[model samples]
Target: MGDYASQHSFRIAIVGGGISGLYCALAIHHHCTKAAVSFKVDVYEQAPEFKEIGAGIGLRPDAAQLIHNVGLGDGLTAIAGGSGDMLYRRFDDGGEIVTVPLSREGSVKLAPCARSELLELLKGGIESRGAATLHTGKACQRVEGLGDSVRIHFTDSTTADADLLIGSDGIHSQVRRQFVSDNATFSGFIAYRGVVPMKSLPQWPLPSYSVAWLAKHRHFLVFSISSNEALNIVAFVTKEESQVVHTKESWTSTCSRGEVFKDFEGFHPSVQDVIKLMPEEVSRWRINDHEPLDRWHYLDGKVVLLGDAAHAMTPHLGAGGSVGIADG
Candidate 1:
C-alpha cells in the first residue's frame, strides 16, 4: 500500500457524473498520465446518461482556464458564446444600474454556455480517454471504510471499492452524509429556470451580453448560448408563492406557467416578455445550501467531497461551479 507503483494499480471511484464528478475524473486522469502512475477510475451516475437541465453557465476567467487545461478548449469554444458586457438592471423599468465588461486583462472573456452543452463536452472528454468507465443508473446508497480502502454500496445491490472516493453528487450527496453529517436547508428561495430560442423574441432586442434584472425579493438572469441561437433565463423569487410545493426530496419540480406568472407579475414588461416565451410547462428548483463542513474527507483521506457537496453557495456570485472545478 505504501508504494502504489510497486503493487497493483490504484482504484478511484467517483460517485456522480455531473460537472464536478466528470471534471474530477478528467483532472485525475490527466494527473495520472503526467505522473506516469498506474490507476483505474470509474464514475457512477444515477441517471441513465449524463443530462443537465438549467439555464446557462457563465464561465469566468478562472473556470475557462481550467477547462482549457482539461483539453476541452475546442469543444467549449464550439459550443459556448462569449458575453461582452454584463448589466444589472432595475426589474420594474429595465434601467441599467451598472455596466461591466466581463473580460479581464491577459485572460479570455467570460463564456456563457448552455449547461447541457457543457456537460456533453465533459462527457465526451471522459469517454474519449478510455481510461475511465462510467456506470449509469447506479445510485450510491452508502459508503463504508475498510482500513485503507473504501467500499461504496449501490441501490442496485452492487458494491465498489476504491483507494479514493470522490463525491460530486450535488447538494443531497450521500457521501457528504457519511463523512460530515451536515444537513442542507432551503434558503426561502426557488429558481424558475428555462431557455428559449432567439428567433421567438424577434421583437425584443437582446445585447451580446448577460443581463440581470433585479427587484424587491426577486431577480431574473438572461444570457445567450449556442452561438446566439437561444437565450437562457433564470427567474428567482421568494418561496411564498411555492408554499404548496416541497422540493426537499427532489430539488427540481414542474409547475404551470400560471404559477410562474403569479410570482412574476410585477417585473418589467421586458422581463415579462421573456418569461412569456418560455414553454407552457416550466421547472422550478429549491435553493438549498449546507453549513460549512469542518472537514471534507473521511477514512484517512480515502474519501472526499467536492463541488456543491462541499460548498453549495448562492448563485449570485456565480463561483459555486468555478470553485468546484478548481477543487477537481
Candidate 2:
C-alpha cells in the first residue's frame, strides 16, 4: 500500500458550506470510500444556517451528470425542472434571433433548479453519506499553515486543524486572500433578478424553453424553475466601471421596481409585461470575476481553492454554478 493509503485517518477542513463546499465534501467522501481510505470532513459556513442567496441556476448537462455520478442523481431528478432549446429574440421588435439547443442527441438534459433547492439536495447527500460535519455561524477569519497541517482561525475565536484545507467560499473568499495577492475584478455588468409565478403570466407568449432577449449592451433571460410553477427573470445591463460603487457590504441589494422599469424602457411589450409582473423589489447584483491563477493550491497542496474562489466568471452562459459543481 502507498504511504497515504496506510495513514490512519485523513482530516479535511472545507471553508464555506455553500454548494461548492458541500459538493466537494461529497466528492471527497465518494473518492475516499472507493479507495478504502478513512477520512473526516468538516464544513464551515459564515451564515447562521445553510441558505443560498440566489434565485435560480441552470446547470449544464455535464454538471447534472456530475451530481449523478456522485450518487445524488435521484435527489436532483426530484427537484430539477425541464430543459430544452434556448430561444433568443431582439428586445426592441421582439424579432427571433436564434434558437440554441442545450443538449444534443443522447446527452443529458439541462437542469434548471432553485439555488436553495440545489443546496438542500447537496446537504441531503452529505447527510445520507455521513460525509461531513457541518458548522454554521462559524466564519473563517484566517488560516495558518503548520507545515504538516493547516489551522483555521474563525471569527468566534475558535480554531481547528486539518491535514488539508479547501476554500470553496464565494468570490470574496477569505481563504484566497490569505495566499493569492490578487482579488476579484468587476465585470462591468450588473444583473437584476426576480421570480414571478407562472399563474400570473397567463398570456405568456414563449414556450417553456429558456429564453433570452438581446439588445445593445444588455439582455434579459427567463427560464422556468420549481417545476415550471415560477419563472426566474434576470435583466443584465452593462454599466461603466465608474458608475459602480463597490463596497465591502453585501454584493446583492434590493432596488425599486421603478429602477428596473427605467432600465428596460422601450423594450418590447412582452418584455415590459414580464418586468411589470415582477415584485415591487428585486435583487441587483454586481457581477465580478477573477483572472486565472497560475495555480489553485498552495503550501504543497495542503491548502487549495475551489469554485468561485478559484475561478469566478460572468453568468452570461449560466455555467458558473455548474463550473463550481465540476470543481467539486
TM-score of each: 0.93, 0.94
Displacement of the residue 113 alpha carbon in candidate 2, Å: 0.7
| lDDT values, one for every candidate | 0.82, 0.85
In candidate 1, how many Å is residue 114 off?
1.5
RMSD of each: 2.1, 2.1
Q: List candidate 1 segments past 4 Å from native.
A: 1-5, 104-106, 240-244, 247-252
Question: How well does candidate 2 match the true structure in TM-score terms?
Answer: 0.94
Instruction: Give me the overall lDDT of model 2.
Output: 0.85
lDDT of 2 at 164: 88
Candidate 2, 1-328: lDDT as tens digits: 2254257578899999988899999999999899978888999999999998658888988899999989888778777775667889999888889988776777667888888899999998899879999999989999998878889999999999888899998899999999988978888888888878778985867764488888898888888887777788888999887866742224357777898889888888888988889878777888887898889999889999999899888999788789988998
lDDT of 1 by residue, 1-328 (tens): 4454259788999999888898898999998899998899999999998898756887777787888897988788787765567888887778878888876676656668888898888989998987589999989999988887889999999999988899999988988888676688777788888888878884754464478888878888888888778888888887763583565324257788787788878788887788789888887777777788888887888998999988888777877777888899
In model 2, which runs have C-alpha deviations exceeding 4 angstroms? 1-5, 103-106, 246-252
